[model samples]
Target: MTDRSAAGTTFDDFVAARSTALWRSAFLLTGDRHKAEDLLQVALVKTWRRWDRLTGGVEPAEAYVRRALVTTYTDWWRRRWRGEVPTGELPERPTTGRDGPGAVDVRRDVLTALAGLSRGQRAVLVLRYFDDLTEQQTADVLGVSRGTVKSQASRALAALRSSPALTDHDHPATEEEPS
Candidate 1:
C-alpha cells in the first residue's frame, strides 16, 4: 500500500529503507536480537503515530525514532521486571562460514563488555560510535549536556578496556616509548 504521508514519504517506504539500520542500533542497545525487534517495533509505531509532525521528513523522523528507541530502552532497564533468566549452559552461536572463529570471539567479547555497561553509558557509546552522531547530537538525543555525553563515553570505553572479556589478548600491543 502506497500510504504517503504529508511529508511525501510512505511509512512502509521509510521502514523498508531504514529498518535494518534501526534494528542494528536497537540490538546494540538491548544486547538481544529479540528485544531489538520488539524495541524497533515500539519505536516505529511511536514514530508512525506522529509521522506527519516530522516536517523535515525521513531524516527527522529517523532521528525522532532513534531518540524514542533510546528512551524506551532506558525505561525498560529501569523497570526491574523478573524477565527471562539465563541458565548455566551457554547457547551455541550460529556461525557464518565467512567469519573465522577469532572474529566471532571478538564480537562476543565486545558485546559482553557492552552489556556490562550502565544503560546511560551503553546508550552513549551506541549513539556516539555506532550511530556516528556528534557529541552534541548525542546529548540532544539523550537530553543530557554535551559534557555528560563525553564523560559517559569516556567511562564506557575505560570499562570496556578493563573488561576481562576484552583484555590484552583481544587487543594489539602498542610499541613502548624508549625511556
Candidate 2:
C-alpha cells in the first residue's frame, strides 16, 4: 500500500498499514493475544470515530490510536477480574530449532518480570523501550508529565534488574537515550 499524508489517508488505509505494529504494542500492554485483539479493536474503533479530527489535527492517526490504546488499557486494568481459570491441558506447538534451548524459558521469565510491574510502569516500559517512543511521546500517550515518564521508566528498569526471574541472564549494554 502506498504511504499517504495524513490529509490524504483513509481510515482503512491507515489500519491496513499500521494494524500489525499497533497489535504488537497492544500485545505488550495486555500480555495475551485475545486481550490484545480486544484492546486493539477498541482503540481502532475509537480512532475510526475520530478519524477526520485525528487526521486533520497536528498529531498523526497513529499517535491518537496509541493514546487510545493506553487509556483503554488503564481503564480495563481498574475493572479487571483477578480470578484465574483452570485449564485441563496446555496447548502444544512444535518448537523451531533456530532459537536454541531455554528461549521459551527466557521469554516466560521476561513476561513474569513485566507482570510484576504496575500498569503505569509496564505501559511506560512498553511505549518507551519496546515501541521506541521518545520520553515526551510516551508522556503524551500516557497523559503524564515527561518527568513522570522518566521516573517510571527508571523504576521499571530497576525493578527488572532486581527481578529474581531475570537475574541469571546477562544483560546487554544499554542504548543511549535520545536527547
Candidate 3:
C-alpha cells in the first residue's frame, strides 16, 4: 500500500467531489441556505486538516466529511452563534437560484418537522434515513450505540408525527412499520 501520507493533491478534487452533498446535509439540518454554505465551508476546513488519514477512499470519501459537518454543527465552540429560520416555511429552493416545484413543498415540510427535534435527535434521523446507513453505522457517526440510534429515531419521529405541519403527510421515508 502507498504511504497514507501520499494521497494526491487535496484542493480541487476534494471540493469537486463532496461540496454539494455536504451543503445539502447542512441545509437539511439547519433549515437555511446561507447557514448551509457556512456549515460546509467550516466542515471542509476540518476535513482538510485530516485529509491524509481520510483520503484512503476505502469507503465513501463523503462519510468522513459528513460526520465532520454534523459534529461541528453541534459543537459548543460557537456558543454565541444563532441560526435563523423563516417565520414561514423555508423556500422550496434558494431564492438566489431556482429548482423544480413538484414535491419541493413536501420536502420542505419534512425539513420543518425535523427542525423541531432536538439537535441529537435530528442528527440521528438525518444520519439514518437521509444517508441510508444502518443503525450501527448511524450510531457510530453520532458516537452512540445502535440502541441509542433506534431510541432517538423513534423519539424524533414520534415528535414529527405530532407536528401540525406534518398533518396528513406520510413520512414513510423516515419511519419503520411495527411488527
Reference-based lDDT, each prediction: 0.81, 0.79, 0.71
Best by TM-score: 1
TM-score of each: 0.85, 0.80, 0.77
Residue-level lDDT of model 3, residues 1-179, one tens digit each, is 12323156454566776577668778777776787898888887776667677655524456777778888888722463445443336655542335544456666777777767888898887787777889988887778889989999989978887776677587444455666
Task: Quote model 2's TM-score.
Answer: 0.80
- Candidate 1 — what's its lDDT? 0.81
Regions of candidate 2 where Cα sits further than 4 Å from its true position: 1-6, 56-59, 82-103, 172-179
Candidate 2, residue 82: the lDDT equals 42
Instruction: Name the regions of candidate 1 deviating beyond 4 angstroms.
Output: 4-6, 80-90, 97-103, 168-179
Which segments of candidate 3 are over 4 A away from where they belong?
1-11, 58-60, 76-98, 102-104, 172-179
**Candidate 1 per-residue lDDT over residues 38-116, each given as its tens digit:** 9999998898888777886788888899999999998887774226332222344777787666655666767777777
lDDT of 2 by residue, 6-112 (tens): 57787777888889899989987876778999999999888887776665643478899999999999888887834422222223334569856776566566767
Deviation from native of the Cα of residue 49 in model 3, angstroms: 1.2
The pairs that clash in candidate 2 are none
